[model samples]
Target: MIAWFRQHGRALAAAVAKVRAQPMTSALSALVIGIALALPAGGYALLSNLSGIAQRTSIEPQLSLFMSTEAKAAETEALGKRLRADPRLAAVRFVPRNEALAALRRTGALAEVFAALEHNPLPDAFVLRPRDAAPDALDALAGEYRRLPGIAHAQIDSDWARRLAALIRLARSGIFLLGALLGIGLVAVTFNTIRMQILTQREEIEVAKLLGATDGFIRRPFFYLGVVQGLAGSVVALSIVSLSLAVLDRAVQSLAATYDASFQLSHLAPADAAAVAALAGFLGWLGACLSVSIYLRQIEPS
Candidate 1:
């Protein structure tokens, strides 16, 4: 392992030096990779932060139970009893039609309609909350509760929760797709770069093959070259992403402050950042390897 490290270290240094010799080309290529990578990387980071924000945001599990106009008072109370007695349910409240009528009267905007009605058409209903916080379980329970006797309907109280979860899922899929495209682009960039390098060093590969060097040995330096390029690009990409997130976090904090919200901005954790860098490095190595292997096969030693 020590010998291998020494060998790789020497190869990495040579690759870095070679890249430095062509500053303009290196800059342009790295920038291309960085920009391509940044979009999806930043998107995933934003989603990560937003998900954390969602968890921190409090949501009251309010279930609305609507009754049919044919429903009577004793039945509503009995329904509330069954829901409240269930182990899965955390809370329940009965909303009588009289109380609902009073509430509308207090609003004043509906006073004329309330006064014109010969009889209250509103049915008595119960509001129920599930003890468990899982949205799927909540939905299932709502479905079951609606099928219960004398209960006309049961539904989630907040449309926002459902909508937000859907939005997150959509964003996640989009980010995944975007990341895949970018990865392919990275490989293309690395492949083209290695191809150019191969052309420049054609004589060296021919001479090495004639000297009895195995394809594996001949491929080592180029693989290292690719790894270096990838590692450098990853560093640059991650830096851009982190800086962008920092700016976004500050903006969010400022906006939250304007609304007097207690919400805080989230930073990308260490493990995630490391994973991003490692992924970039692997992609770079793979891209380089593909190009070198294909070209090496075609080179005829004269």
Candidate 2:
């Protein structure tokens, strides 16, 4: 037990000392990893904000049900009542043809034309609010409403809403894929760096082998070296991510205040922050292992 403890103590001390000796180089490498990680994390934040907007728009979605020109007011009122009574309905608004025509005139641009018209050409319409009006739910409800006996046509109020939601989803996926590619770059960078370090120590490794050191004994230090690099890189990455978010949040909040919005943009939730750190560290560690394993085998210096 004493021998094992002494050997491990020496190895750890050496690895740590090596890092301390090259503070500038180590710091630069960590900063590089941090920058790479921050790009993806920022992209993800943009996606989250867009998603929130899309969700807010989807709430209380309504289907517009227009009646035929000859449809009676009683028929429209009855339809409104029936819609309100349905379990799937939230609220129903009835617009008479004359009231709809008046609304058009109030928009000001159509005032002259609306005055010239002899009859109210606008049809009676029902504005429907559904209980669950997410894109898919609204679509299904619109399909059912279009088939109703008295309804001339049922139209989804926000056709563009669904498209926006789809676009946001696509953007989010793209960001995630981009993050993955950047992570690969990080691993590549770390691996190359470790491989170079191993080659630099070839003479010392050969001397140890001549002294009857086993493969495990030589390999253990390189493994420890990888862990150090990975941990350092993670610390750097985390700092970058946090600092970038802090800067961005201030900018976003400033813009939001102009619009009188109660917007407080969120950062990476706890789970996501942990995931970012863990992923960065794991990649760093894996990169070191790959580099060390390949070169360690190439050096049969004994």
Per-residue error (Å), model 1, residue 140: 11
Best by TM-score: 1
Taking the tens digit of each residue's C-alpha lDDT, what string does model 2 give over 1-302? Answer: 99888877777677677678778877777777778887887788767777888898963467899998877777777777788889988888888878999888886556888999998888889888888867788889888887876778888877688789879888888998999999898888788877777777888987888898877677666666666776677666666666777887898888877654556666767788777777877887788778877876777545
lDDT minimum window of 10 residues, candidate 2:
257-266
lDDT of 1 by residue, 72-173 (tens): 677777776777789987888888878988887766556787989988877776777778768888889888888877777787885576567668889999
Give the C-alpha lDDT of model 2.
Answer: 0.78
Candidate 1: worst-modelled 10 consecutive residues by lDDT? 259-268
Please list the C-alpha lDDT of all candidates, in the order they appear.
Answer: 0.81, 0.78
Query: Highest lDDT among the candidates is held by which one?
Result: 1
lDDT of 1 at 155: 76
Error of 1 at 2 (Å): 7.0
